[model samples]
Structure formats: structure tokens, C-alpha cells
Target: MKKFAMVSLAGVVTLGMVAGPATSLASTHEDPSTTDYSDVDTGHEEFNEGFNIYLALTNGDVILRQGDQRSEYVSDVQRLLDTRGFSTNVDGIFGPNTADSVRSYQDTYGLTVDGVVGPNTYQSLSDRHPYPNELFRYGDRGEYVMEIQRFLTEERGMEMAVDGIYGIETERNIRVYQEYSGLQVDGVVGPKTWDSIFTYVR
Candidate 1:
């Protein structure tokens, strides 16, 4: 009877070990590496699914969907979009506003209207929208405005913040840049000014 009891105890311990692992597995799940945000319908929901896609845009490895953070890459995208006539604030955030602008650009350029900045969309933007058509002067606000500020700060060796607003300091720098680049001395960023600036800096 003692040996029989010992055998039954061993069987119970074996069953407990098996059940412990199973119970643990049942209660645990693998953490998802990336949030799947493709099925988001509303603009509000789309903005809520923000992610970071700040990698280089080589071969479209870094996709800018609705929920991407406002990185320098997004700033570049906004510059391109503003150049192409889809006017959206170049605030770097990939919210519904940016998505709507991207879709407009895609539709106008005969690309797929998925509201995503992929390889094809990026290529189209790079190829077509080379520069902003409108004049970027004092009081102008956008990524391109910031780009001019960046060019002034980096290439021409100026000391200032690269804020997107075309404030008095930015205008002063633009005039300086224009004078240095042999362009018109006006503190405006039209096509000719942009051409000269791009030639000098980019």
C-alpha cells in the first residue's frame, strides 16, 4: 500500500508539471513588433496609429503611411507636396491632413491612391515637384521655408533656428543668400530664387 501511494503521488506530480507549462503558454502571447494599421477607416483613427518611419527612403524601405511621425523625411515629403500644389502645413506629423495631401498628389500624378508615400509615389514627387511655385517670403510658413532657413544656417554659415516660419530673421538671411548667390536681392523665394538656392546649397 505504501508503494502504491508513492506511484500515485509521482503520477500527480507529472500531471502538474505538464499542466503548469500548458497554463503558462495559454496565458502568454507573443508581443507584436509592429502595429497593423492598414484597416483604419476614419481620419481620427488613422492619426491615432502613429509610428516611426524615419529611416532613409531607399527602395521605399521606409513607408510613410497615415500613422507615421513627423520626421525630416516627412518634412521632405511636405516640401515636395507643397511644390506639387497640394498645400498642407509642413509640420512633420503624418496625420490625416498630410494623408489627404498625399492622396491628392497621387491622384493628380496618376499613381495608386493608397495615401502612402512609397517608392513610386516618392519617385513621382522627386521627378515632378522639383520646387515650390509660389513665392516664399516673410510670413510664409512651411517645410520649404524651413529648408531655406536650414540652407542659410548650414551652407552659408548663419546662426539661427530652422523654424518653418519666414520671420524677419529668415527674410534677412534670404536676402543675404540672394546677394551671395548673384540672384535678385529681393528677400523672396520664387522660382529663380529657389533655383539659385538649390544650385548653391543642394
Candidate 2:
């Protein structure tokens, strides 16, 4: 287990608290996942924008694979793979380690063992692999917890290392997210809290 020095934030928090007074819920509207991908062959402006939108959509094209192509999408897939327990360096490089992890994921999820993230593989991964609504608290350590840390870092703009250890820093970030999402300001991440985060992602 990696040790992270817990940093204190300016809030009165008691560890493991949940179910407080309800706060104003934020609008949980997710934008439609629509994108025109007819121009991927032309490599024009349409191709560029469509390809990017395709990548951003969870059910996007399989442009990321075991090669030297580097992008934030590769890094995002790496992070999701790390969260699913097929550990690989999250350096945004789709190297052998990432390929091996992808293969492992394919095997575990009953997908084709091609070591490539094509449409089928990507869809299965996007749908099946991610955990849904797991309660996270301090002293817990694993990819599940690491996911929350990653969300705080990537989505919510929190400054912290993604070490998979739920310490004070992680809890502090969760509290911040809770406050921002208009949910109860408890550090614990239950289904409601998870839903709030998911709404933001969509």
C-alpha cells in the first residue's frame, strides 16, 4: 500500500458520516451523445471534429490501440483499465503493458482476445467493466477507491495524486465534490453521491 500524507482542508468533517440534511440537487441533465462521423475517411475538418466527438462518446470508434498513438483518450482508457484491476502505468502511452492489460480485460469480460480496442471490445469495456455505486470511505484501498480519486482529479478539478488509497485527501476531495454537486456534504460515496458524479460526466 502506498502511503499518502493526508492534507487537512477547511471543513468540519467526521469520518464515515452519511445521510444528512438534503441539499439542493443539481440539474442532472446529460447532453445527447450525438455526433456526425461520416467524414472520418476524408480527414477534413468534419473528420477531425467527428473523430474527437467519437472518441469522447463512450461508444466511440476504436482509434486507441497497442501502438505509439498518444492522446488524452488513451490516458482515459488507461485510467479506466487501472480502475478495473489490470494494472498499467497511466502515462497515456499505449505500449505493451496497456496491450497486455487490454488482453486481460478482454479475457475476463468474455470478449475476443485480440489485444485491440475495437468497437466490440470498446463497447463491452464501456458497458461491463466499470463498477456501479460502491461505497467508499477512508482506510479503504483499491482501484475502486482510486476511481473516485481519478474522478476528483480529472472531472472535478481536485489536485491530488491517484494512488488508490482512500485517505484524508481523498475524503477531502469527495467532500468538495459533494458540496459542489448540491448533495449532502458527507464524505461517503453511496449511490446518490455516485449518481451526482455520473451526471457531471455525461
The most accurate candidate by TM-score is 2
> How does model 2 score by TM-score?
0.46
Question: Tens digit of lDDT per residue, candidate 2, span 1-202?
Answer: 1222232236532222133312222233221122232322221333234335334544544466788565566766676677667898989789999999999999998988978777666555544223343466655665556666765565344566797766656665666666555778767878777755533422
**Which portions of model 2 show Cα errors greater than 4 Å?**
1-57, 123-150, 154-156, 160-192, 196-201
Clashes of 2: 0
Q: Write candidate 1's Cα lDDT for 16-135 as tens digits.
A: 122122122112332222223233222222111211221245366778888788476787778668866798888888989999999999898799999999978876665412464557
The residue pairs that clash in candidate 2, if any, are none
Best by lDDT: 1
Tell me the TM-score of each prediction against the true structure.
Answer: 0.39, 0.46
**Deviation of model 2 at 115, angstroms:** 1.7
